[model samples]
Target: MATDHQQCPVAVIGAGVMGTAIATTVLGSGLPVVLLDVGQAELDRAERTIEIQLRHARMMDALPSGRAPGRLVTTTSSSALAGARAVVEAVVEHEATKVGVLTDVAGIVDADTPLISNTSGIPIDTLADPLPRPQQLIGTHFMNPAYLIDLVEVIRGRRTDEATVTAVTELLAALNRRAVVVRDSPGFVTSRLLHPMLNDAARLVDEDVATAEDVDRLMVGCLGHRTGPLRTADLIGLDNLVDSLAALYERTGEQRYRPCEQLLAKVHDGHLGQKSGRGFYDYREALS
Candidate 1:
């Protein structure tokens, strides 16, 4: 039998931006979370990030009042995942890295506990291939600032069972989020459609067609997009965006998904957007 969601903590295997955001979302929903990372520094940073985000949410009245936030446990040990009601893998985008984490997590959590992957583009089936129970593996592509995003793209792997999908959708519902189930595909729906636009946006900048600010201005002001492609790339982290683009390109053999030279150069310089204070645009001042 599946464990009670209310009584057991959710295991978040990563302390990066998405992991931290997901943990914050789960905690805000009043469910305890075990946040695991390989680095103590990263775990410490994640804890701080969660605290600040939660505090800000409370201030903006984004989180419900009069309910204490759920407890958060940060650790570097996979053993801490024992008895988790569910496991969310938000590790790095590399196939090997994700597969390794999921394989380890499978051994710790209950056999029936849902395993959700927050991969931006990787096919859920590919990640599930090495797992003991592929049916329990599904993808929950939580958008950036997961606490604020109301919709999540749910990907059903070839072997993913209906029960796993139902349980995951129900969990998301409890967080006040809607899940749009989509068939498994390289990059799935969001990244397949999104990365091409981001690539073209970067190419425009590379070719001197427009400045990053003006490009974003055109998209936001005239195109009715809330955020422009370049800005979105920055928020996603240029490094991570490049990795996703490369994966999409490799998986689909599509030229449109190729990472632009400018983006690659930016990452090489470590101007990793909001995280590094620079990318398509400088964010040091804003971040400071």
Candidate 2:
């Protein structure tokens, strides 16, 4: 099981924030990266995001003195990943979408290439069920701001092989991150506990027990958290939070995992947090 660097160029699918962050981190680690998405516009946006991150790193003296941004290649086709040693799928958190992307990636890469998913809560076995080689399909849930997050949740499906886990864990280590290997469970460790708290916060807002601001203030002040649970939900996006909650409910049939009505209402209104410019707080002006 060769690490990402040993394989040279790594293929990172999806050009969203997480995808760009993973690609940038890989490139910063001195491995060539091929970033693939559905359209040229998406690729262009990913490129810009990557460049901005790179420049920021340089300003902070995080990148090697002579490292050029040219280490990254952007494309609209998965075929460009033919030479990649491994592929990481950071697409949307939908089961069908992730299965489709992983199926397509399996077709393009070598049989032994490690296929990783950055799903926050979807069960690994469910995502791997459709792939030809489920043993290679593992979860590498990197927190947001992938480049800066030192902790990565490595999830192993029932069929996931030790070699695949070792390869991914070693690759993360190479990039100066810690890996906490966990079994394939809905929400794994972080999301299982975190989402319930976030949903409870939404419940408080729904019940008018406290305003979103007050609840957040309590978490930051009383709980000693850097960010309030509601603000964190805003950052995670209302739609995403709902999806995670739904996934947990579907898997566990637990009432607590059911998304609060207010969360659902906000998603329906399209106030999807930072990306959509509004959620618990308005970001329209700041987004512009």
Say which candidate scores most in TM-score. 1
37-107: candidate 2 lDDT, tens digit per residue: 99999899888888777777666666544555538888887788775767899888789999999998888
Alpha-carbon deviation at 222 in model 1, angstroms: 0.7
Q: What would the per-residue lDDT of candidate 1 be over residues 125-156, giving only the tens digit for each residue?
A: 99999999999999989988887777999999
Look at candidate 1 and give me any clashing residue pairs: none
Among all windows of 10 consecutive residues in model 1, the one with the lowest summed lDDT is 58-67
Find the candidate with the highest lDDT and give its number. 1
What local lDDT does model 1 show for residue 121? 91
lDDT of the candidates, in the order given? 0.89, 0.85
Poorly placed runs, candidate 1 (over 4 Å): none
TM-score of each prediction: 0.97, 0.92
Worst 10 contiguous positions by lDDT, candidate 2: 61-70
Query: What TM-score, to 2 decimals, does candidate 2 have?
Result: 0.92
Give model 2's clash tally: 0
